[model samples]
Target chain A: MEIEIERNLVMPGDVVPCPTGSMPGYGTYQNEVGEIVSNVMGYPAMYNRLVCVNSLRGCYIGETGNVVIGRISQVGNKRWKVDIGASQEAALQLSSIDLPTGEHRIRSEEDQLHMREYFNHNDLLSAEVQSKSQEGKAINLQTRSSKFGKLKNGMLVVVSPNLVARMRQHFCQLNNEVDIIFGRNGWIWVYYNNTNELEVPLIRRQQIVRISCLLKLMNKALVMISPEKIQQVFERTSDIELEDLLAESTLERIKDIDAVE
Target chain B: MTEEILFYGFRQDGRRPGELRQIKIKLGVVDNSSGSALFQIGHTSVLAFIHGPKQTKHEKESGHIHCYFNTAYFSSSGERRKFSKGDKKSNEFEANVRTMFESVVLMENNPHSDIDIHVLVLADDGSVECAAINAITLSLIHAGVPLKDFLVSCSSGFYSGMPLIDLTYSESTSFQVISEYRVAVLGKSLQIAYLNYDDIGGHKLTPEVVREITAMAIEGCKQVHFIMKQELQNACSN
Candidate 1:
């Protein structure tokens, strides 16, 4: 049988019980006295033999195989520098990306010359972390899949990356005909489900706005976000006006709702 | 000698010789920065903002920490004094603060990144550098930056055959005090990170006197660490 432990908030230097043979994980270190201690401000959890603390808030740290949405800040000679809200800009090298032709062939020098034609500065796109550089100084990104490409006709909302839990699918479409791409790096894109339509219907627009407001509220309250919680918040606030959802009283009510859960 | 700062074995603020001033801390006060904190130690107040662990334009550097310390004209009680953009005193203070944090913050975690700390003095009564260190610690915690331990600092002054902890500006500058020292301690191990002393009126301190003063300052630092821990826990809960 596995022993269960309650989540408790911990600060730096707080001693944590590591038991006899337990191992310390991230956000924790072993002291000279053989006691496990936390190195950051967060909640402590015990997973079998491993104990680690989940940081409450902080800048996003990217890892390989994660899908992230970022803006192109610079176009280098053969790579485009993308800001994925991490410490370092991820590099989308010319060799990594699939050309517009979608052909798997050797790249010519001419292809490197026209790297700008593929992605311009300030353009937003979704990509996957391919690998880390040899020195671990920079991240390498790839955009070869159909889903990973330039984001168009969408509104971006940024939040703390910690709030976004890893999920099987970061893309979701609500029943109200609003599509959302929850970037692992804390950037969320909301748009109408019907991309072919030039003008989004009033109801779809209102739903998108409602989702945006919900995201903002969760961020402000510093609550862990999930698809179920977002849906519940959206449904609960359906009676209230979209603009009024941001009112202080409504925000307070939402906080109470979250606490009860 | 007529106006004695120590009256009936208590200081002018009615604190004991080894007592510290009231300390208050608030976290995440600023929205734009990655992390921010407002810290107050008695009349002295410091607002700290931390940005990044972000990419630096220049390459080849593992990680960089930059700090800027600024004092407002109206922070002091006396006549307002203007400071030029390149004030030497403020520049030196900023450099000292930056070096202190570079040792405390775990720069090895984020290689090739930059962490910038901006500290603004809203009020100056005394011990501004100590207050700045406390504020920076809170802001770094708020930003979720990894660190070996919290760095708590306190100042002590030897005067009238007694050691005073957490001295105010008036007490430090007063002719009654002979030597003053500021000490920063790592919270977990209680190891001294930085220490500096100055003779206020050319009154040098002996080895025994220096030891006594340092002990008092370390005690003050422990008290400060207690308060910081409580404040950080509160911030985490809410």
Candidate 2:
């Protein structure tokens, strides 16, 4: 079967170029006259009978099973509020997280009082979106797996959330040197290694910093970021110094975009 | 009072009756704000910044719109007065702008948040509100805030029995406008969103004058929207 891809820029109040019977999807609304109109500025696309506009600069909207990186903003009763750069702070219920010892047991009353010890304010962590709240727009996050927990010795870099493509595996090891988590909320965390944070090799540290810089450079150029693009940029920019990685010349050269058209 | 406001069917600045001042728009000037734009028309300039949908102290069923209108002390020539934050004129103008955008933005979509629009008049020759409205519209687009339509605004007035569009400071005040009107509209549909005017030259408010001036203002807004759309497309294409 052949696939078709057609995209045209449309802003708010612009009528969508869709068949008269198609239903409107995200980033669009049907008027009283039943004509589909775009409510955001973006590229309108058709999927089956639904038409949606992929907005250019919109903030991240949540989805189930997606990974996110966030900082603990507040500790409340039976829950922790996290700043994931979304419309509302996500909630991590006391019962949804795994204890530090990897033991799978019921969360007792003590856990509610000692919530700060598990994830205090300003502590960064990675988790998967479990669900959205019933009455509100808040997202519910879970850290049931060993892979999701407090992130240390890693620096966070934020870009446009849409630039981070959805992939099967968000956690990846780059060149066997650094661990990268591409959060759907545009927060990227890169660390050398989970076990060895107190002492680090000089070369590994430079590589980790370089990856963060490259992510920022791609963001400035409005290019989509994926692991394949990262590896491609890494292999191509071998001659450039770490400090010069984000220079205008370097950004212009590595912009052979593969994913974002 | 014998100064010739119009010489040879041209305004003092050499623009014809229907002609608008040269417009220049620049987006994303403020890195921190979600959206920001600077709009310049003739010598009048306004900078607008959109900050949120951010968490506020109180959450509601719909988002709240806040407008802060500030005129920099140096914005207007020959006026060295400090525009205090609570100036009654500024407060009224700010409320009018806020209400203008509240009708255009899709507030129901952004539940439990605050969208703050801060408009700064960097230079004032005439029609700062029109420039501010244009700047805020561009800023909202840049921020990707959902809107019903682009809210484009323009000011016009009657000069010596002949109607003029996009009146300058001198044309509005010095030339003794027979009538002056400011309008904000949904550009694509030409639906009037807000309207206010004053006729100080003692000209009778006739239906003919109203129709003619309104058509002129709508035309001005359409021209502005066209220019903005073109610039935005070109800016992102490369």
Query: How many clashing pairs does model 2 include?
Result: 0
- Each candidate: what lDDT? 0.83, 0.84
By lDDT, who's the top model here? Answer: 2
Worst 10 residues of 1 chain B by lDDT: B77-86
Q: Kindly report which residue stretches of model 2 are placed more than 4 angstroms away from their true locations once superposed.
A: A1-6, A134-136, A201-203, B59-61, B198-207
Taking all chains together, the TM-score of candidate 1 against the true structure is 0.91
Q: Encode model 2's per-residue lDDT on A168-206: one tens digit a residue.
A: 889999978788999999999998775745777788778
Please state the CAPRI-style docking class of candidate 1. Answer: medium
Q: Under CAPRI classification, how is model 2 graded?
A: medium
Runs of candidate 1 exceeding 4 Å displacement: A1-6, A20-24, A30-36, A46-51, A132-137, A198-207, A239-244, A259-261, B1-3
Model number with the top TM-score: 2
Cα lDDT tens digits, model 2, B99-140, are: 888888887676777889999999988888889899999999
- Measured over the true interface residues after superposition, the C-alpha RMSD of each candidate is 1.5, 1.1
DockQ of each: 0.70, 0.71
Residue B121, candidate 2: how far off, in angstroms? 1.9
**Deviation in Å, model 2, residue A11 alpha carbon:** 1.2
TM-scores, all models, native as reference: 0.91, 0.93
